[model samples]
Target: MYPSSALGEFLRSRRARLQPEELGLPGGVRRRRVAGLRREELAPLAGVSVGYYIRLEQGQAPNVSDEVLDALARTLRLDADERRHLHRLARIPQAQTSLPPTEVLRPGLSHMVEAFTDAPAIAVGRRGDILAWNPLAHALLAPHWPVMPTGRPPNFVRIDFLELAFARSLYADWAAKARDDVAYLQVSVSNFPGDEQLLAFIAELKELSPEFRELWAEHPVSNCATIAREYRHPQVGAMTLAAELLRPPDDEGQGVTVFQAEPGSVSQDRLRRLAELTSGSAA
Candidate 1:
């Protein structure tokens, strides 16, 4: 079966996440069979006709003006990234998603990643495939895998959901990480609406993992470029690192994520120990 239209699904999910009471709607939040503001309620608040809003939500409205979308965004109380996503869904033409032919990290970027010898760094492709990583990154992220991966590469989504034992053991807050992964995937889907392959990727994940299925249905969208992550390394104990996702100016589809701890902090010391331990083990 075909997936629901991304535009329509996104709108419905956003609407369902909001509550009448939160928006200070009249009638004092009576119990209802349906959740969130109904089309009739939302339309007036967004300064559009109920029928028109319904049409937009159903993906029937075409060439919708930015002013109207902005009104909808404001009324929905969408965050900056979400507002941008809504605009893209309303205004951009449908196109198939295309990724680079090679999964190899760019030469310059790979060098940069390696230059972060003290910190953990990884390069990933658009679809979450791990392209390259430094030794510390290898030890920190996926010690279960080879130093240089062969055959199938490690993936962010697969590693987080499919490798439950490892993920649960590794992250201090596995639930938060799951949300981040699913939301980032939504960002990818929104970037390329009507992409069958991307839809299939979602379908496969849903089929395999109930948690992923539930989160995917929630339709959360986030573009987290930097986040403080807590890692419970089996070898070196607990540490917190700021993971910064950097995309090259020339390439939007690939990113280098560097993990570094605050100077003079306990986490920084643990990270150093991890680097030494991993290197010694390899030696």
Candidate 2:
């Protein structure tokens, strides 16, 4: 389902976003009947026939080649992530069968999370579940986590975009961040066509939020590495935190996103003090 229908949807989404004028085509010649670029127009741009593009979108075509996929991605102005997704969909030699359900975090990973004292670290599964976190992680991400206890593994994607109050209070640039996170998740989902939770999550998000629906239609892949996020903390007031993501070699889905402040800065000092006050309080 992922590498098959998802590719079609992804391509269609990209085509729907651009205007004739944006693509340097005549805009006022005739009243457009459709919502997005026409198949004929896109076919030429992608160096394919109208019938071929139509077949690809309709999932009637055979496996797409890398060269053709790259051309389509370039024509659609895809980013690094989007391009990779295009390749992924094209290169999946075997037809998609049924995918497995989500896997819960292991106990050893939970113990590792519990051992972290000052660092705000959490073990997130492939689908972005909270999985496990130390007290400091809970304290720092409390704004995003809501009242759901650590064991329940609250999903950050759902919390940020769906829960209006939590999103507005926790992140000033909520929409941008949410879109990035969504795109990231989409890329991950595309990578793992055998992930059932990924498919279900995409379906649910598409149904629930109009903004998410619109953005999902674009099919942009979110692969931006570094971002400075502004957090309006209840205790520390307002501070911009720079986040760095570290991926473990053994686990493809697991990664540690560590937050830090600028050197010799008050925010840094405050974070250090906060760590001192609350570090290693096992409860």
Candidate 3:
């Protein structure tokens, strides 16, 4: 994908969400044609000419200065992550190397997951593929799905958005979770624009799921670190868990995710029972 196109889309999406009155601009009595601040209105507030802003929005502006980018970022109320993404898109190189290779869990990392008998911990690759998981995590996340062979990884995005019916049943707030997954994928794309496999996965999702396509078009980006998720496990009934995402020190795109419940809470009790059940079955 062209960086210019990505930058333009991101800018336009951000602009469309801001109301004119939010920036202290007067809302005229006449109905506005566009949803948010018009291009003309945004240009002056961002300290740039209307023609230049138009060119920038149309992906025709070249050699955009830092001052102008910062001005536009401020005008659009971009957060730190969004600002970084903006910079990455605007400073694209003519040639980009392929994404780094898929990460495998170190022996120590694998042992760590084995040690977490009660909690659910899993390692995932950049493309949302499950790299490694303990029995508890496997039981919690994909009890009903068929297991892939040893070297092959199961993609969470495909299961959640396209093929698996159990995914809808797994998450209590399916829509919100689905959107977060898409947004996370969006951020990953900005980081690795040259990954053909990643691009193909995105294309397949767009063709398979209308919801995924709609969410992808919004250009939402995030680095999800902590989240409270509710899951309705087939064996455990209902439980709310806190998910913590950790990137290994040596790995850039791979992450280790752990799920836990409050001590002595009902959810924790349920988790204990679920773990026992999985352990018993494994033996």
TM accuracy, model 3:
0.90
Ranking by TM-score: 1, 3, 2
Tens digits of lDDT, candidate 3, 22-86: 99999889988778888988999999999999898777876888889999999999998788888
Clash tally, candidates in order:
0, 0, 0
Residue 4 alpha-carbon offset, candidate 1, angstroms: 6.9
lDDT of each: 0.82, 0.72, 0.82
lDDT of 1 by residue, 92-155 (tens): 4644445434455688888888889889999886667788899999999998898777786788
Return whichever of 1 and 2 wins on lDDT: 1
All candidates: TM-score: 0.92, 0.84, 0.90
Model 2 agreement with the true structure over 1-283: per-residue lDDT tens digits: 5566777887878887878778887777777886677888889988999999889887777667777888898888888877887777666545454555656666666676667665567777667777766666676676345535644457777777678687778787887778777777877776667777778887887799787787777666765456788877677667677866656667566665667778887767766666765554332
Off by over 4 Å in 2: 1-3, 92-94, 97-118, 143-151, 208-211, 249-251, 280-283
Compute the lDDT for candidate 2: 0.72
Error of 2 at 265 (Å): 2.6
